[model samples]
Target: MKRFWMAVTLLLTAGVLGACSNLGFNDSSESTASSGTKTATYQTTGTVDSGMYQGVIKNGRYQTSKTRGLATSTNTQSGTYNIKSMENGLLDLAKKQFSTSKYVFQEGQLITEATAENWLGRKSKDNANGLNPASNGKLDEDTRAPIYLQTLLEQDFMTQSGSKLQLGGIAIALGMNEYDYYQKVKYGATYTTHISDAKLVSEGESMAAEIVARLRRLSGVGKNVPILVTLYKNAGSDALVGGTFFRSVLSTSGSDLGKWSTIDQQNETLPTVNNAKPLDSNVSTDFSDFSEQIENFFPTLAGVTAQAHYQDGSLAGLNISINTQFYSETEIMSFTQYVATTAQKYLPDGAKIEITIASTAGTQALITREAGAKGFYTHVFGSY
Candidate 1:
């Protein structure tokens, strides 16, 4: 089929050039072209001394050509296309197609209109930047140029090298990729695609790899690199901050024939809180001496207990509880300030320090380490 198309295009080119030449439409000349119904006026705008602007009009379209060596040639088509409209149409078509396809996204339970919209927005942003002129600044993905280029390239390849486009194959490949990305990020399931689906050569390489690579290439924002979706969560809260579903493509080695790497880069961090949790046993031993020193610094204080939280083998935060009797709120606050300043010297680097002072006067003072300061900052209100 590719060979057939190439032959047809070559013959058409030869016929067009012959007809133009016979009609005295050569270098530095102008002529009117007609295709039964559609006609266009094309004018060459270069000197006869140089082979420039060698073009012809047909079917209301103007086209130019340049030939270097016998095997080297180039062609350019001149016409106007509505990029904004084309992108919008393609995005809408893709959304509709995916909504009904096997790759439909299920939100929390089942796919609803709201879920569909969310999925579309997510996938589009993951693939493109999610630009929509129709909506208020943001609507859907702007896919006009890539799709347009793909169409033109498909035609040119068919005309030049007898290669046909695998429209169905491309669609299937992209669908599979999206399905895998969603499954892993949303459902915590992991899988891989084998490279040995088939062994066909296109342009002296594995056609399967070529197709997959191109699909990934088109699924990116710029330079047709690749798109990766990543999700993040933590043990602290049921809320997750990053279901944004976009990341960088690491390497081509992870994406080749017979091998598709797993996407497992989810990260979790302890949420920052005023109250401190239990310290790791190894880190807990260092605080005993410090607690004694804090008690000695304030002989009037009844008792003191310190809890240090560790993150990745380093101190993350510190919370000190002070027990006292008859101390006024101001006196309790002053005690917390003393502890804040004294603890900073002994606490691990980068540890957030908080001091809670409880007194028999039915008043409590909660002081936090001041930002960009070495002293107590402000009171934080919360249950002890």
Candidate 2:
């Protein structure tokens, strides 16, 4: 098809040039390109040199030679296509006879304005940025352009890092490579990717390797990546984020294709909280941490009978929290222990916490962690 366009464009160029030179055209670069003929007159100024007829811009039309060699142009029509029912099957808007198309951008080597506008899940506008422009992106696993751009968009969408775009939808990736095809779904505005392949080969030279490499780059966003996940959608994709295409790097795993050489990468990313935007949301907004507020609700003035080992009077204290629904002594003791355990995930070495239940008011139970390390972890508990 590209060759066909090239040929057609060449013929058009010949016709245009032939018409221009026949009217006793004797001037060089300074020649006027009147639309009609010698009877018409007009002029404009650019790099006008009477000696420079290098065909770079001769007869007021860009030439297909020199710095721009054999450039071709083919007009593919485009128009705002209202959502016609999909019952007729996916329409091929690239062909004029298929549907009324529109011009996207003829300024470069390729013009997919029609596809950019009306592809399955794309915005009617946005053939700019040289980005995919479509809601979904180009996914040629074998090529770096599509996958890298997809990774960029995915990162932005996950962190809501840049201007956010869209949410869960069924989308397709258009590309020209081995990771050339697949479906991606946008759920919770995060992306989950799945693959449909005849074989999942993790061998060094196989297509699976390229796919894994691309995914690893995308997953570098870590837990900051949003989790717009869905086990199933009508589009048959497991997940999506901001509509960028993502194929599970794990596709190379579970069989001869297992591990995908990403076990180390995936291991690092698995523990990051993607679905919960903890940092993006309000600090006190209760979410997946419901089990940490019991002690604050009841102020219990209780005594502890444990070994308060303070080595050489160092700054050490016990951290406590009540873990009981009734806020009883047993619960207070549990709270004390829980805080100490939770502290391990956030304290400095050798620092300690001493937990004490003060008292229980009407509906409030007070728990305290008498630790010198408390100040160091104030931000963490204060957010609680």
Candidate 3:
């Protein structure tokens, strides 16, 4: 465990969502998909969000509370895989770089390229676009990619109780997101790939509720549990990489993603030794020009004040009332400040800011959801 954390930090010092598959929200482009430039339609299916996606993490802990009296659990995860999207030309260039390397997850262990191709790698024309050099924008976890943090839970992360694993290690999934800006004129949409770990255990609703009660005591909640979203572009080969702002969604499931279907809508082609581009760090998300959006903007949360009876038959359990309080803020500015000084792990370069207010109990404010809102409505953060 110590070695894993150390390795991640070192590699991270060096550099480094939603709902699909076990990971959630996969944009698998099928054979029927259109060209890299052609516009397309999508459909979706999976778990209904129901605000469960609006989570807040404090000191690296996520306090999860179910809508109704249901099972409570915790999850953590870490793993590695690359989802590259580019133009046909750039993908060809990148393939050469991957030749000597078979996409290693760590020091010397080489994962099967065929396995990666079927699961994480591209196999079709659309999937190939993932490695193409024509990409005008970076991948967006909110859109093109599925939130596989949960998907990889079984392998990447282990469960303590929810779904017990007798031999695997603790699963802890981390969410690091990046947004793209160049599409249409520059390209089309977003692209993404990730690594995660998960550890989950099921508990009585009463116990789950009890945990939620303890979380209420945190001061300045929103200050600690904030999310960052970025807009990056010009990531493709020199021929087509231009500039533009892009948008996507961070969700648990695409089951009800309006008309957005996650399966088989992506460019499935991949880069080979003969066709690939050099992988480089493009735009930085933690820039002063970007902004963030928050969902639950609570000022201070003492926790859910409720009566415990049915949630758990245990007399020791207390009833918790989920008195829903709403806050909206353009927290981009303040959040960026915190990330610059404290969150060196994610926002080492620093990010922009937007003000968002969702809820307030006292000095502690709770932020439910936050993301990078770039476009005509880009600067608009928080729920107004």
Candidate 4:
């Protein structure tokens, strides 16, 4: 057990340093604060992707989000996958509009943790600013109003001016629930009320507009800061895959939102379990072939699965998981090598690919190939 953890630590250190170098970022470099003082740039500890920005330090200290830890607080109501997708997906979408070359990322500092909690709760005499509709004294799903808005996430983008960083833009993602699950009485039977697509979109846009206006009124936030708001529809509590953003709006200037644009993104489990039809037949077949090759190579493997992401009917990324029973270092390395080779051969072209090989104990190896890259980076735990 100790050896396994030791291997993981070394792998993580190498991966982080390598990723920083690849992104052309000096994580150790110092930057001048707005107060005319110098401090180390605050580099984030982890990333969803190696290509993601590690974030720029503001002031002398790392400014933690005013609404930190809220994601987990609502993770029960919103599935864990949905929570992750809402945060990471927003960053991916924001990069399209806010280029990484021009802007340095920062956590949302404008919204306080308390304010976020209030807004996510049901409106009442004490909390009138709540985004969720006021609760009437009804228990039935039909009569009771559903909580449309689940959580709000804010991401700040900054532009470097000399050694100091200034707020260049902001991206806010609102996570809306597809179904409102609640217990009629405390610890009693739980009931769910389905929220239609039309209603979710309509309510999301209205909430976004209000959020924009409120943001403009904040002290540090001026009327000119470009704000991008996106609405994410969360998957059901029992869903294996997370939901995707349906609509987005960009306010380049002033408080009023511009036209909303449709985002055609989706998440699907590969191999089409339960006789479900594949969304993309070609990709599914390729994955099936890849799995078959791996299993045939090592018949003792427990199982193989993958989660495929798509944008506009095109493959965007693939995350594959391989469960193995082998623990020997040499065997793991051999399997990893074969998996990487087979992945390049069978996976669709022009999409990011990541694969993890794990045993009953823990992760044994990792392989990744960036989109458009011809080769893969393979790392087997304890191999070194």
Ranking by TM-score: 4, 1, 2, 3
lDDT of 2 by residue, 23-107 (tens): 2322222233322212123111223332211122225553232212222221110100101111011121111111111111011
Task: Name model 2 segments beyond 4 Å from true.
Answer: 1-126, 130-140, 144-334, 341-347, 350-384
Over 166-222, each residue of candidate 1 has an lDDT whose tens digit, in order, gives 111111111111111112233345332121111101111232343335334432112
Off by over 4 Å in 4: 1-50, 58-61
**For model 1, the run of ten residues with the poorest summed lDDT:** 1-10
Give per-model TM-scores. Answer: 0.26, 0.18, 0.16, 0.84
Clashes of each: 3, 42, 133, 0
lDDT score, candidate 2: 0.23
Residue 323, candidate 3: how far off, in angstroms?
56
Better of 3 and 4 by TM-score: 4
Task: Give the distance in Å from residue 153's predicted Cα in candidate 2 to where it truly belongs.
Answer: 12
* lDDT digits (tens) for residues 168-280 of candidate 4: 78898888878777775566677888999999999999999989998887666657889999999888777778889999999977777999999999889876779799889
CA shift of 180, model 1, Å? 26
Top model by TM-score, which number? 4
Error of 4 at 31 (Å): 13
* Candidate 3 positional error at 33, Å: 48
Candidate 4: give its CA RMSD in angstroms. 9.3
lDDT of 3 by residue, 65-103 (tens): 221011011111112221111122122222222221111
Query: Could you tell which candidate, 1 or 3, scores higher by TM-score?
Result: 1
Sorted on lDDT, best first, the list reads 4, 1, 2, 3
